[model samples]
Target: MAVNTSGRTTAVDRAYSALLAEIQTGALPAGAVLAEVEQSARLGISRTPLREALVRLAAEGFVVQQSPRVTVVAGIDEKDIRSLFELRRGLEELAVRAAAERGDAAVFTALAESFSAAATANPGLADPAAHAGYYALISAYDAAVGDAIRNDYLASALRTVHTHLVRVRQLAKDNPERLVVSAGEHALIAGAIAEGDAALAAHATHVHLHNALISILSSIAGSSQTSTEGTP
Candidate 1:
Protein backbone atom coordinates (compact mmCIF):
# COMPACT_ATOMS: atom_id res chain seq x y z
CA MET A 1 0.00 0.00 0.00
CA ALA A 2 1.14 3.49 -0.80
CA VAL A 3 1.82 5.85 2.06
CA ASN A 4 -0.75 8.55 2.77
CA THR A 5 -0.43 12.29 2.18
CA SER A 6 0.78 12.61 5.73
CA GLY A 7 4.57 12.72 5.80
CA ARG A 8 4.77 10.67 8.93
CA THR A 9 5.41 7.05 8.13
CA THR A 10 5.55 4.99 11.32
CA ALA A 11 8.90 4.79 13.12
CA VAL A 12 9.14 1.04 12.94
CA ASP A 13 8.18 1.06 9.29
CA ARG A 14 10.72 3.73 8.48
CA ALA A 15 13.45 1.92 10.34
CA TYR A 16 12.59 -1.34 8.66
CA SER A 17 12.61 0.21 5.20
CA ALA A 18 15.86 2.02 5.83
CA LEU A 19 17.70 -1.00 7.14
CA LEU A 20 16.35 -3.21 4.43
CA ALA A 21 17.37 -0.70 1.77
CA GLU A 22 20.88 -0.54 3.16
CA ILE A 23 21.23 -4.30 3.19
CA GLN A 24 19.58 -4.69 -0.18
CA THR A 25 21.78 -2.07 -1.80
CA GLY A 26 24.97 -3.59 -0.39
CA ALA A 27 25.72 -0.50 1.65
CA LEU A 28 25.50 -2.89 4.54
CA PRO A 29 27.21 -5.81 2.82
CA ALA A 30 26.78 -9.42 3.75
CA GLY A 31 28.42 -10.48 7.04
CA ALA A 32 28.61 -6.91 8.30
CA VAL A 33 27.97 -6.43 12.00
CA LEU A 34 24.84 -4.57 13.09
CA ALA A 35 24.72 -2.86 16.43
CA GLU A 36 21.29 -1.84 17.58
CA VAL A 37 22.68 1.00 19.69
CA GLU A 38 24.56 2.46 16.73
CA GLN A 39 21.64 2.04 14.41
CA SER A 40 19.28 3.69 16.86
CA ALA A 41 21.69 6.59 17.19
CA ARG A 42 22.11 6.92 13.45
CA LEU A 43 18.40 6.74 12.68
CA GLY A 44 17.52 8.95 15.65
CA ILE A 45 15.09 6.39 16.95
CA SER A 46 14.82 4.62 20.26
CA ARG A 47 16.12 1.11 20.86
CA THR A 48 12.57 -0.15 21.29
CA PRO A 49 11.57 0.68 17.71
CA LEU A 50 14.93 -0.36 16.31
CA ARG A 51 14.60 -3.72 18.00
CA GLU A 52 11.15 -4.11 16.57
CA ALA A 53 12.48 -3.27 13.11
CA LEU A 54 15.34 -5.73 13.51
CA VAL A 55 12.95 -8.45 14.56
CA ARG A 56 10.86 -7.85 11.47
CA LEU A 57 13.96 -7.89 9.25
CA ALA A 58 15.19 -11.08 10.83
CA ALA A 59 11.86 -12.76 10.35
CA GLU A 60 12.04 -11.81 6.67
CA GLY A 61 15.57 -13.36 6.29
CA PHE A 62 17.51 -10.12 5.88
CA VAL A 63 19.37 -10.46 9.13
CA VAL A 64 20.22 -13.36 11.35
CA GLN A 65 20.56 -13.13 15.12
CA GLN A 66 22.89 -15.90 16.12
CA SER A 67 23.52 -14.22 19.47
CA PRO A 68 23.22 -10.78 21.06
CA ARG A 69 26.69 -9.63 19.95
CA VAL A 70 26.81 -11.59 16.70
CA THR A 71 23.90 -10.45 14.60
CA VAL A 72 25.00 -10.01 10.97
CA VAL A 73 23.59 -9.29 7.59
CA ALA A 74 22.50 -12.59 6.09
CA GLY A 75 24.45 -13.79 3.07
CA ILE A 76 22.57 -15.37 0.18
CA ASP A 77 24.48 -18.58 -0.35
CA GLU A 78 24.29 -20.52 -3.63
CA LYS A 79 21.42 -22.73 -2.50
CA ASP A 80 19.46 -19.81 -1.15
CA ILE A 81 19.94 -17.83 -4.35
CA ARG A 82 18.83 -20.77 -6.50
CA SER A 83 15.75 -21.37 -4.38
CA LEU A 84 14.80 -17.71 -4.34
CA PHE A 85 15.25 -17.39 -8.10
CA GLU A 86 13.16 -20.48 -8.68
CA LEU A 87 10.32 -19.00 -6.66
CA ARG A 88 10.78 -15.64 -8.31
CA ARG A 89 10.70 -17.17 -11.78
CA GLY A 90 7.41 -18.91 -11.04
CA LEU A 91 5.74 -15.89 -9.47
CA GLU A 92 7.00 -13.40 -12.07
CA GLU A 93 5.76 -15.68 -14.84
CA LEU A 94 2.30 -15.59 -13.31
CA ALA A 95 2.45 -11.84 -12.79
CA VAL A 96 3.57 -11.21 -16.37
CA ARG A 97 0.83 -13.45 -17.70
CA ALA A 98 -1.80 -11.65 -15.69
CA ALA A 99 -0.42 -8.25 -16.59
CA ALA A 100 -0.46 -9.14 -20.24
CA GLU A 101 -4.02 -10.41 -20.08
CA ARG A 102 -5.54 -7.68 -17.89
CA GLY A 103 -3.17 -4.74 -17.49
CA ASP A 104 -3.97 -1.47 -19.25
CA ALA A 105 -1.87 0.88 -21.34
CA ALA A 106 -0.74 2.71 -18.22
CA VAL A 107 0.78 -0.45 -16.85
CA PHE A 108 2.69 -0.97 -20.05
CA THR A 109 3.85 2.63 -19.96
CA ALA A 110 5.05 2.26 -16.40
CA LEU A 111 7.06 -0.84 -17.27
CA ALA A 112 8.56 0.88 -20.28
CA GLU A 113 9.52 3.85 -18.18
CA SER A 114 11.15 1.58 -15.63
CA PHE A 115 13.16 -0.18 -18.34
CA SER A 116 14.27 3.18 -19.66
CA ALA A 117 15.40 4.20 -16.23
CA ALA A 118 17.35 0.98 -15.81
CA ALA A 119 19.01 1.34 -19.20
CA THR A 120 19.98 4.90 -18.40
CA ALA A 121 21.32 3.85 -15.04
CA ASN A 122 23.25 1.03 -16.66
CA PRO A 123 24.26 2.17 -20.09
CA GLY A 124 26.63 -0.71 -20.72
CA LEU A 125 27.89 -2.57 -17.70
CA ALA A 126 26.54 -2.18 -14.18
CA ASP A 127 28.90 -1.19 -11.41
CA PRO A 128 27.79 -1.43 -7.82
CA ALA A 129 26.15 1.98 -7.78
CA ALA A 130 24.57 1.54 -11.19
CA HIS A 131 23.20 -1.84 -10.18
CA ALA A 132 21.68 -0.38 -7.04
CA GLY A 133 19.77 2.14 -9.10
CA TYR A 134 18.79 -0.61 -11.52
CA TYR A 135 17.41 -2.67 -8.65
CA ALA A 136 15.25 0.26 -7.59
CA LEU A 137 13.99 0.58 -11.13
CA ILE A 138 13.17 -3.13 -11.28
CA SER A 139 11.32 -2.86 -7.97
CA ALA A 140 9.20 -0.09 -9.44
CA TYR A 141 8.54 -2.29 -12.48
CA ASP A 142 7.48 -5.16 -10.23
CA ALA A 143 5.22 -2.88 -8.23
CA ALA A 144 3.61 -1.49 -11.36
CA VAL A 145 2.93 -4.96 -12.71
CA GLY A 146 1.70 -6.22 -9.36
CA ASP A 147 -0.74 -3.33 -9.14
CA ALA A 148 -1.87 -3.93 -12.69
CA ILE A 149 -2.55 -7.58 -11.96
CA ARG A 150 -4.58 -6.58 -8.87
CA ASN A 151 -4.26 -9.97 -7.26
CA ASP A 152 -3.41 -10.16 -3.59
CA TYR A 153 -1.70 -13.54 -3.90
CA LEU A 154 0.44 -12.40 -6.81
CA ALA A 155 1.42 -9.27 -4.92
CA SER A 156 2.39 -11.36 -1.89
CA ALA A 157 4.53 -13.63 -4.05
CA LEU A 158 6.29 -10.70 -5.68
CA ARG A 159 7.09 -9.29 -2.24
CA THR A 160 8.97 -12.44 -1.36
CA VAL A 161 10.86 -12.39 -4.66
CA HIS A 162 11.82 -8.75 -4.22
CA THR A 163 13.53 -9.55 -0.95
CA HIS A 164 15.83 -12.11 -2.60
CA LEU A 165 16.16 -9.93 -5.69
CA VAL A 166 18.25 -7.50 -3.71
CA ARG A 167 20.95 -10.09 -3.23
CA VAL A 168 20.64 -11.48 -6.73
CA ARG A 169 20.95 -7.98 -8.11
CA GLN A 170 24.24 -7.57 -6.28
CA LEU A 171 25.60 -10.84 -7.58
CA ALA A 172 24.57 -10.03 -11.14
CA LYS A 173 26.32 -6.68 -10.92
CA ASP A 174 29.56 -8.60 -10.86
CA ASN A 175 28.90 -9.45 -14.50
CA PRO A 176 28.21 -6.22 -16.35
CA GLU A 177 26.98 -7.80 -19.58
CA ARG A 178 24.16 -9.30 -17.60
CA LEU A 179 22.80 -5.81 -17.09
CA VAL A 180 22.49 -5.21 -20.80
CA VAL A 181 20.82 -8.56 -21.27
CA SER A 182 18.46 -7.85 -18.38
CA ALA A 183 17.42 -4.51 -19.85
CA GLY A 184 16.70 -6.16 -23.17
CA GLU A 185 14.69 -8.87 -21.45
CA HIS A 186 12.66 -6.27 -19.61
CA ALA A 187 11.90 -4.54 -22.88
CA LEU A 188 10.73 -7.79 -24.45
CA ILE A 189 8.56 -8.64 -21.47
CA ALA A 190 7.05 -5.16 -21.48
CA GLY A 191 6.36 -5.34 -25.20
CA ALA A 192 4.65 -8.68 -24.79
CA ILE A 193 2.50 -7.35 -21.99
CA ALA A 194 1.65 -4.27 -24.00
CA GLU A 195 0.45 -6.46 -26.82
CA GLY A 196 -1.70 -8.50 -24.44
CA ASP A 197 0.20 -11.65 -25.27
CA ALA A 198 0.01 -13.37 -21.91
CA ALA A 199 1.76 -16.53 -23.04
CA LEU A 200 4.59 -14.66 -24.68
CA ALA A 201 5.09 -12.43 -21.67
CA ALA A 202 5.24 -15.40 -19.31
CA HIS A 203 7.66 -17.26 -21.54
CA ALA A 204 9.90 -14.24 -21.94
CA THR A 205 10.08 -13.65 -18.20
CA HIS A 206 11.00 -17.28 -17.58
CA VAL A 207 13.72 -17.24 -20.20
CA HIS A 208 15.07 -13.99 -18.80
CA LEU A 209 15.33 -15.40 -15.28
CA HIS A 210 16.90 -18.64 -16.49
CA ASN A 211 19.51 -16.72 -18.45
CA ALA A 212 20.30 -14.63 -15.40
CA LEU A 213 20.78 -17.71 -13.25
CA ILE A 214 23.12 -19.24 -15.78
CA SER A 215 25.24 -16.11 -15.95
CA ILE A 216 25.50 -15.81 -12.19
CA LEU A 217 26.37 -19.45 -11.77
CA SER A 218 29.01 -19.18 -14.46
CA SER A 219 30.56 -16.22 -12.71
CA ILE A 220 30.57 -18.06 -9.42
CA ALA A 221 32.20 -21.09 -11.01
CA GLY A 222 34.96 -19.02 -12.54
CA SER A 223 35.62 -17.29 -9.25
CA SER A 224 35.96 -20.63 -7.51
CA GLN A 225 38.34 -21.90 -10.17
CA THR A 226 40.50 -18.80 -9.82
CA SER A 227 40.58 -19.19 -6.06
CA THR A 228 41.59 -22.82 -6.33
CA GLU A 229 44.35 -21.96 -8.79
CA GLY A 230 45.75 -19.37 -6.38
CA THR A 231 45.71 -21.66 -3.35
CA PRO A 232 49.10 -22.58 -1.94
Candidate 2:
Protein backbone atom coordinates (compact mmCIF):
# COMPACT_ATOMS: atom_id res chain seq x y z
CA MET A 1 0.00 0.00 0.00
CA ALA A 2 0.97 3.65 -0.49
CA VAL A 3 2.46 5.40 2.55
CA ASN A 4 3.54 8.98 3.02
CA THR A 5 6.76 8.40 4.91
CA SER A 6 10.06 10.30 5.17
CA GLY A 7 13.64 8.96 5.29
CA ARG A 8 15.17 6.62 2.74
CA THR A 9 15.72 3.81 5.22
CA THR A 10 12.13 3.97 6.45
CA ALA A 11 10.87 3.97 2.88
CA VAL A 12 13.05 1.01 1.97
CA ASP A 13 11.96 -0.93 5.05
CA ARG A 14 8.32 -0.26 4.26
CA ALA A 15 8.71 -1.54 0.74
CA TYR A 16 10.73 -4.54 1.87
CA SER A 17 8.20 -5.63 4.51
CA ALA A 18 5.25 -5.26 2.17
CA LEU A 19 6.91 -7.13 -0.70
CA LEU A 20 8.39 -9.82 1.52
CA ALA A 21 4.98 -10.64 3.06
CA GLU A 22 3.38 -10.93 -0.36
CA ILE A 23 6.21 -13.05 -1.69
CA GLN A 24 6.18 -15.41 1.29
CA THR A 25 2.40 -15.71 1.18
CA GLY A 26 2.39 -16.43 -2.55
CA ALA A 27 0.68 -13.14 -3.35
CA LEU A 28 3.79 -12.49 -5.44
CA PRO A 29 4.32 -16.09 -6.44
CA ALA A 30 7.43 -17.46 -8.07
CA GLY A 31 7.98 -16.29 -11.66
CA ALA A 32 5.97 -13.10 -10.97
CA VAL A 33 7.76 -10.04 -12.33
CA LEU A 34 8.26 -6.91 -10.24
CA ALA A 35 8.52 -3.79 -12.36
CA GLU A 36 10.36 -0.98 -10.63
CA VAL A 37 8.15 1.84 -11.85
CA GLU A 38 4.92 0.03 -11.04
CA GLN A 39 6.05 -1.14 -7.59
CA SER A 40 7.48 2.26 -6.74
CA ALA A 41 4.19 3.94 -7.53
CA ARG A 42 2.06 1.28 -5.87
CA LEU A 43 4.15 1.28 -2.71
CA GLY A 44 4.31 5.09 -2.73
CA ILE A 45 8.07 5.02 -2.43
CA SER A 46 10.73 6.46 -4.68
CA ARG A 47 12.32 4.12 -7.19
CA THR A 48 15.65 4.43 -5.35
CA PRO A 49 14.25 2.95 -2.13
CA LEU A 50 12.32 0.28 -3.98
CA ARG A 51 15.51 -0.67 -5.78
CA GLU A 52 17.30 -0.95 -2.48
CA ALA A 53 14.53 -3.17 -1.09
CA LEU A 54 14.73 -5.36 -4.18
CA VAL A 55 18.49 -5.64 -3.80
CA ARG A 56 18.04 -6.90 -0.22
CA LEU A 57 15.52 -9.50 -1.38
CA ALA A 58 17.78 -10.56 -4.24
CA ALA A 59 20.69 -11.07 -1.87
CA GLU A 60 18.44 -13.32 0.25
CA GLY A 61 17.57 -15.35 -2.90
CA PHE A 62 13.94 -14.31 -2.85
CA VAL A 63 14.19 -12.64 -6.26
CA VAL A 64 16.52 -12.39 -9.23
CA GLN A 65 17.24 -9.45 -11.50
CA GLN A 66 16.83 -10.38 -15.12
CA SER A 67 17.52 -6.87 -16.44
CA PRO A 68 18.05 -3.33 -15.18
CA ARG A 69 14.38 -3.01 -14.16
CA VAL A 70 12.99 -6.52 -14.23
CA THR A 71 12.97 -8.71 -11.10
CA VAL A 72 11.36 -12.12 -10.79
CA VAL A 73 10.64 -14.14 -7.67
CA ALA A 74 12.79 -17.22 -7.25
CA GLY A 75 11.33 -20.73 -7.25
CA ILE A 76 12.26 -23.47 -4.80
CA ASP A 77 12.68 -27.16 -5.64
CA GLU A 78 13.39 -30.40 -3.77
CA LYS A 79 17.12 -29.84 -3.90
CA ASP A 80 16.73 -26.37 -2.46
CA ILE A 81 14.55 -27.69 0.38
CA ARG A 82 17.10 -30.37 1.19
CA SER A 83 19.92 -27.83 1.28
CA LEU A 84 17.93 -25.44 3.46
CA PHE A 85 17.20 -28.16 6.00
CA GLU A 86 20.84 -29.21 6.13
CA LEU A 87 21.77 -25.71 7.23
CA ARG A 88 18.71 -25.32 9.47
CA ARG A 89 19.29 -28.61 11.26
CA GLY A 90 22.86 -27.76 12.08
CA LEU A 91 22.14 -24.20 13.22
CA GLU A 92 19.01 -25.01 15.20
CA GLU A 93 20.48 -28.02 16.93
CA LEU A 94 23.40 -25.94 18.12
CA ALA A 95 21.06 -23.09 19.05
CA VAL A 96 18.80 -25.27 21.18
CA ARG A 97 21.73 -26.78 23.00
CA ALA A 98 23.04 -23.36 23.85
CA ALA A 99 19.62 -22.09 24.79
CA ALA A 100 19.07 -25.02 27.12
CA GLU A 101 22.29 -24.34 28.93
CA ARG A 102 21.88 -20.60 29.08
CA GLY A 103 18.22 -19.64 28.78
CA ASP A 104 16.12 -18.25 31.59
CA ALA A 105 14.02 -21.03 33.04
CA ALA A 106 11.00 -18.78 33.46
CA VAL A 107 10.99 -17.64 29.83
CA PHE A 108 11.05 -21.14 28.43
CA THR A 109 8.66 -22.39 31.10
CA ALA A 110 6.06 -19.87 29.98
CA LEU A 111 6.56 -20.84 26.36
CA ALA A 112 6.36 -24.51 27.18
CA GLU A 113 3.05 -23.93 28.93
CA SER A 114 1.74 -22.01 25.96
CA PHE A 115 2.73 -24.83 23.68
CA SER A 116 1.09 -27.32 25.99
CA ALA A 117 -2.17 -25.38 25.74
CA ALA A 118 -1.85 -25.37 21.98
CA ALA A 119 -1.18 -29.08 21.87
CA THR A 120 -4.33 -29.70 23.88
CA ALA A 121 -6.53 -27.30 21.94
CA ASN A 122 -4.97 -27.84 18.54
CA PRO A 123 -8.30 -28.38 16.78
CA GLY A 124 -8.65 -24.62 16.78
CA LEU A 125 -5.69 -24.49 14.39
CA ALA A 126 -7.90 -25.79 11.59
CA ASP A 127 -9.00 -22.20 11.27
CA PRO A 128 -6.72 -19.92 9.30
CA ALA A 129 -6.67 -17.25 11.95
CA ALA A 130 -5.88 -19.73 14.67
CA HIS A 131 -3.11 -21.19 12.58
CA ALA A 132 -1.65 -17.72 12.16
CA GLY A 133 -1.59 -17.33 15.93
CA TYR A 134 0.07 -20.72 16.24
CA TYR A 135 2.79 -19.62 13.87
CA ALA A 136 3.23 -16.47 15.91
CA LEU A 137 3.92 -18.66 18.91
CA ILE A 138 6.53 -20.47 16.85
CA SER A 139 8.14 -17.13 15.99
CA ALA A 140 8.18 -16.12 19.64
CA TYR A 141 9.85 -19.39 20.53
CA ASP A 142 12.48 -18.78 17.85
CA ALA A 143 13.16 -15.31 19.20
CA ALA A 144 13.41 -16.61 22.74
CA VAL A 145 15.98 -19.17 21.65
CA GLY A 146 17.89 -16.47 19.81
CA ASP A 147 17.97 -14.36 22.94
CA ALA A 148 18.91 -17.23 25.20
CA ILE A 149 21.73 -18.49 23.00
CA ARG A 150 23.53 -15.14 23.38
CA ASN A 151 25.44 -15.64 20.16
CA ASP A 152 25.18 -12.80 17.69
CA TYR A 153 26.46 -14.61 14.61
CA LEU A 154 24.23 -17.66 15.18
CA ALA A 155 21.16 -15.46 15.63
CA SER A 156 22.01 -13.46 12.49
CA ALA A 157 22.33 -16.59 10.36
CA LEU A 158 19.04 -17.90 11.74
CA ARG A 159 17.30 -14.69 10.70
CA THR A 160 18.15 -15.46 7.07
CA VAL A 161 16.98 -19.07 7.32
CA HIS A 162 13.69 -17.94 8.89
CA THR A 163 12.94 -15.60 5.98
CA HIS A 164 12.69 -18.52 3.55
CA LEU A 165 11.01 -20.72 6.17
CA VAL A 166 7.83 -18.64 6.04
CA ARG A 167 7.49 -19.44 2.34
CA VAL A 168 8.39 -23.09 2.89
CA ARG A 169 5.57 -23.46 5.45
CA GLN A 170 3.05 -22.45 2.80
CA LEU A 171 3.78 -25.68 0.94
CA ALA A 172 2.04 -27.75 3.61
CA LYS A 173 -1.00 -25.59 4.36
CA ASP A 174 -3.29 -28.46 3.47
CA ASN A 175 -2.04 -30.54 6.37
CA PRO A 176 -3.49 -29.19 9.58
CA GLU A 177 -2.85 -32.60 11.09
CA ARG A 178 0.86 -31.97 11.07
CA LEU A 179 0.43 -28.65 12.84
CA VAL A 180 -1.33 -30.48 15.67
CA VAL A 181 1.57 -32.84 16.24
CA SER A 182 4.04 -30.02 15.79
CA ALA A 183 2.68 -28.23 18.83
CA GLY A 184 3.56 -31.18 21.05
CA GLU A 185 7.00 -31.41 19.48
CA HIS A 186 7.70 -27.77 20.23
CA ALA A 187 6.46 -28.26 23.75
CA LEU A 188 9.04 -30.98 24.21
CA ILE A 189 11.85 -28.75 23.04
CA ALA A 190 10.83 -25.80 25.17
CA GLY A 191 10.15 -27.98 28.19
CA ALA A 192 13.55 -29.53 27.84
CA ILE A 193 15.22 -26.14 27.71
CA ALA A 194 13.29 -25.00 30.75
CA GLU A 195 14.67 -27.98 32.61
CA GLY A 196 18.23 -27.29 31.42
CA ASP A 197 18.54 -30.51 29.47
CA ALA A 198 20.72 -29.62 26.52
CA ALA A 199 20.77 -33.07 25.01
CA LEU A 200 17.01 -33.46 25.15
CA ALA A 201 16.44 -30.01 23.69
CA ALA A 202 18.83 -30.62 20.81
CA HIS A 203 17.40 -34.07 20.15
CA ALA A 204 13.89 -32.64 20.06
CA THR A 205 14.94 -30.02 17.57
CA HIS A 206 16.55 -32.65 15.36
CA VAL A 207 13.45 -34.87 15.42
CA HIS A 208 11.18 -31.95 14.68
CA LEU A 209 13.25 -30.89 11.67
CA HIS A 210 13.49 -34.47 10.44
CA ASN A 211 9.74 -34.94 10.49
CA ALA A 212 9.13 -31.54 8.94
CA LEU A 213 11.52 -32.24 6.05
CA ILE A 214 9.94 -35.60 5.34
CA SER A 215 6.45 -34.12 5.38
CA ILE A 216 7.38 -31.29 3.03
CA LEU A 217 9.27 -33.48 0.58
CA SER A 218 6.40 -35.93 0.53
CA SER A 219 3.94 -33.13 -0.12
CA ILE A 220 6.05 -31.91 -3.02
CA ALA A 221 6.45 -35.40 -4.46
CA GLY A 222 2.72 -36.01 -4.25
CA SER A 223 1.92 -32.78 -6.02
CA SER A 224 4.41 -33.50 -8.78
CA GLN A 225 3.02 -36.97 -9.32
CA THR A 226 -0.52 -35.66 -9.41
CA SER A 227 0.43 -33.10 -12.04
CA THR A 228 2.19 -35.76 -14.13
CA GLU A 229 -0.75 -38.14 -13.96
CA GLY A 230 -3.12 -35.37 -14.99
CA THR A 231 -1.15 -34.48 -18.10
CA PRO A 232 -2.93 -35.42 -21.34
Scored by lDDT, the top model is 2
Per-candidate RMSD, Å: 6.0, 5.4
Least accurate 10 contiguous residues by lDDT in model 2 = 223-232
- Report how far off residue 106 is in candidate 1 (Å): 5.6
lDDT of 2 at 25: 74
Q: What is the TM-score (0 to 1) of candidate 1?
A: 0.74
**207, model 2: CA deviation in Å?**
0.6
Q: lDDT of each model, Cα atoms only?
A: 0.75, 0.83
What number of backbone clashes does candidate 2 have, counting pairs of residues 3 or more apart or in separate chains?
0
Residues 86-155 of candidate 1 have per-residue lDDT tens digits of 8888888988888888888667866776775565553433555565666566666777798889899779
Error of 2 at 158 (Å): 0.8
Q: What is the lDDT of residue 185 in candidate 1?
A: 84
